[model samples]
Target: MIIKTPRLKKGGAKNVYLENVSHAVTRPAMESRRVQMYLLMLLADTAVLLGSFVLAGGVYRDQWPNEFAMAMGWAFLPIFLVIAVYQRCYSIRALDEVRYAIGQAGIALVLSAMLCTVMIFYAKAATEFSRVMLSLALVAAFAGMALVRVVMHLVLRRIYGPSVSSVLVVMDGGPKVDIRGAQIVHAEDFDISGVQSSPNSLDRIGRLMRGMDRVVVSCAVDQRTKWANVMRGAGVRGEVVSTALQELGAIALEREGGQSFLVVSTGPLALHARIFKRGMDLAITVPAVLVLSPLLLLVALLIKLEDGGPVFFVQQRMGANNCLFDMLKFRSMRVEKLDSKGARSTSRDDDRITRIGRFIRKTSIDELPQLLNVLRSEMSIVGPRPHALGSLAGEKLFWEVDADYWQRHALKPGLTGLAQVRGYRGATETENHLKDRLEADLEYIRNWSILRDIKIIFATARVLVHPNAY
Candidate 1:
């Protein structure tokens, strides 16, 4: 009876197993680092707030927000930044990866931008402050905060192990069940993750499992033999119970130390293709937004003045995994209509188009507002087109001949892609054309790259020039 004692509690962050979170429960080993990470982010956010204050000349001038109010404004910047980080964290942490911490740095910047926007709205700071300087500072804070977290990751990795956590157990049933159990036990902590195992030698395995705070065994392991059952009975009194197979995929591992055993598994979002797609999206879209801002605004105003209506139009669109976002586009339709409910595709002689609206839509100027969508992260520079999941096209939109359908939306929906550059635009009236566009979309997703996007944009430039008069 080498009673094992497990350390980790259930509901850990690494595993996305269950979802009743007052926030993901921290495992024992991470308790300290988790606290440290929060504190560090708080301090870093405070620093950024102070920097914003300094940039605003220490306070807003007369008729503007004053010193104390400005200080409070600085304070809210962090409050909002932290909240934004938290909202992004739910999915971001579940999909834990090396790149996530880096990507989150940008998320932090976007939060900061929103906070700044609020500040500008309230006139809490200098009206003439340069957007360039603010952007630079936000970028700096993102880089600095992320660099710190990476250092923390490295330190924790070295201190703990190059791995996450592991669990091992040694069960003795009969000679029949003994060999299989022993082989599994022998694999030991080699997996070096939260749920690693080595069940080869019974004594060795028992020793290893007992070394942790808690250990679990499958119901099957109990039926090995009478003596094994007796041993398992004693083990059960002290340890937890779970299938041996379940141990193979533990995302979060609890640590109770050399004389203890505790096990837990939960969030596990970051995976192969998902990670790659996210990396590429971040690498390209962030810089593109900075470069394309002027173009986006120019087109926006042209739409507004031409149609005498709102510059941007937002419509519900299905996002990744059936999530929803208000997809943005420059309003390219007429504002004089009595009803706004039934607007659809503009055609060759559509009544909605103003002289300017027609030109912009023909040249795809209406799509430029989405560059801001890219900045806000609702869309991408190049990927599959997004469809409203409850689309008007009916179930056929998904089931109808687009073989690689789901894979196309695997990446962020883009403003332009290979399909569009290949001339798959306008009314998706026929099933064949939709199928062709879907095929092109899937091809782009399957083989995606910055160079490919550049190629698509280049081809689109050619298409825009001719305008087909439609």
Candidate 2:
């Protein structure tokens, strides 16, 4: 027998996918300049604020800023900058619109004035500072900031062509859609960076996204999942035109040529929002664990006393990005060498469930240990529920049942989720059950807010008594 080995192509499949596109535009220089622009804008805004303070002092007291007045005005600088950052005023996206800049500046002005009032009251300095001058300063701050922004915007427009955002448009099968500031790039063009998706047509759009402002995905409804997963992984600002986005309500609708399309942008959570969400998680989870310590101890004792087995169960569960982490639960089933994949879905009145397990599972008290997981950052307080690797619906694995199943893992797994609150919890037997759960998860991801998370948490309390949980 003659031994023969095939020679491997150089650069591998990735290089092959990337080789077609030669004119790959990278945005590092533009991005660096944009940062410089943000800094320059901040400096200009500071000058306007100081000028407003001086004007207010002169108007109110017939003098330029005194030492105390200057001190007060300078003190407002850090506060103003903090509020501006929290409001994302310096963000490139914020600069995209004049209204956005004015709104953010107004908010910062109001907040700064409110903080000044509170500080003066608390420090017993209200009698020292001129209230009328302070009021004028507040008004002037807003007016001055807005004026500065308008001037800077006009100047920048003249200098740099308005900094209009560009997007890469990827079309699957649809009438030619014209998007402003978008370049249509074929998936077959590999001279530019492209994402090789299917065997027939590679998803070259990924390669073209380097310096692009955003990506507009217009594909068949069935192919939405594929595009969504790709964009989610890319961590790029993207918008998908889908009828499903109409669920996001009137705000997401864009009308073109009397035709309405639901446009959903996959921008990452704002820094302040992310901080607020994480703060909420820590706020609730920390105190709940502390206050419920006795109850947790009681549950642990019950699990231990039932069959002299381990009180806590640690099992691997899929978390964000399909990463596995050891998830904790109060031991609710009979201690045995069971499959880790949760191959055997727990049905109502299952024999594997111990006496204590039956009670805990029904009330969802068994999930309380996951609060530690929340504290550890392995999970979130409100997100899609994680599942075991072997978790299945009927005879097939969960991912095998639906292509979009892994998308749920894009967010951290939670102790409870939108699916549970919507009555889609417990053993998923049919494909429809899984689909319902997936839909709820996707909806949660799309519409996540601090208020929505609070609502889900409140809704989960009602679901704890749900009869289907067991």
Candidate 3:
């Protein structure tokens, strides 16, 4: 994880010697300061919210405390916290920039206060709390929170030396990079490779990335995928330097020191967004399963009676992050003719399908068992549909159709997706057929929202018995 300067030999030749330099490069004392700062800012904002209302109460009514004012503060605190988190008020960027921190905090406070006032008015509790006191509290709270952030920013910069976040740049046979304030290490010096399988190599890489908030890798095009795999589980913001304008599945572009880098790995959704999506999934799936239990049982029984084979067909499909998972479905093919790899596309009047199998496939009853996958978190109620590993488009695999095909796996595969609702389902007969679905899938990922997901679920009802199902 450490590097030493190449020493010159007695004959005036440069001889490069690499050794463990852990003792030479000291680890930052505030390695976990990012989390600490987030907690500190949250607590500071809460304290300010309560304290401001208390102070306002004393000023407005000549009382040291007011019950209504305290209640208002408590109600407003949660709203403010939620808004602030969504606005990135306590993020690393906010921590480093005083103006950004203050602006986001102020906006969050304003929005929360407005929402609280509206709620109180609707609840008919406006008569209990004075408008003048509420206004005063809002003003005081905004000023207090902004002041706290400014002070925190200055303190963090002083304590952590200019940048609160640590960035590590690993150079591995790519262009030389000079990132200001970033610790640079030669990948060769440490014998690092994206395809490396040694435990010691992985451990050393982990040690090098211990205190980093972001790790950037500069490697050859062939090594990008390997490095990406390594960084996906590295527990940090990972980027790969590339000259190409677009890289497969890049989430964003980062420019540093007149050079561009592709942000290859990041959580697709923010924390709050992920919570909302998951909540929606559970809210719908749990009840759907309970309500349709009778129908599900009937179908399972029919399939079992039709064939003495397994009732459910479980095939390995690529899911989020290119990880494979067993995608469940009601077995819709004859037991002896089951194609586990899905190499052959189903055709109308396919002899492999039994009478019940054809009926279920045509009605999409075969897909109902995947609701269990949604419950297992291996799939979502709405996302890009996961494909069988051997599924093909015009004799080529799905991924082989386009490089960005893997990008669709950024989110959990869904029970029904935008592509399916738009009638892009069934056997992909050509490359263009796959491309059409791929475009819709990528579009869905790029503009994902709870509302859109709900719409897709509803639209799917209309396409459940499409002609392509055969």
User: Candidate 1, after superposition: displacement of residue 458 in Å?
Assistant: 3.9
lDDT of each: 0.53, 0.75, 0.82
- TM-scores, all models, native as reference: 0.38, 0.51, 0.51
lDDT tens digits, residues 164-220, model 3?
767777788888766655667666565554336777666666666665777889999
Residue pairs that clash (backbone atoms under 3 angstroms), model 3:
none
Runs in model 2 deviating more than 4 A are 1-122, 125-270, 337-339
lDDT measured at residue 302 in model 2 versus the true structure, 0 to 100: 86
Q: What is the lDDT of candidate 2?
A: 0.75
**Residue-wise C-alpha lDDT for candidate 1, range 187-259, written one tens digit per residue:** 2222222222323334332333332323333333443343234345335223323345344533344556555
lDDT of 2 at 154: 80
Give model 3's TM-score versus the native structure: 0.51
Model 2 lDDT tens row, 140-213: 88887788778777876676444545456766654355664455654333322223445323334444466666
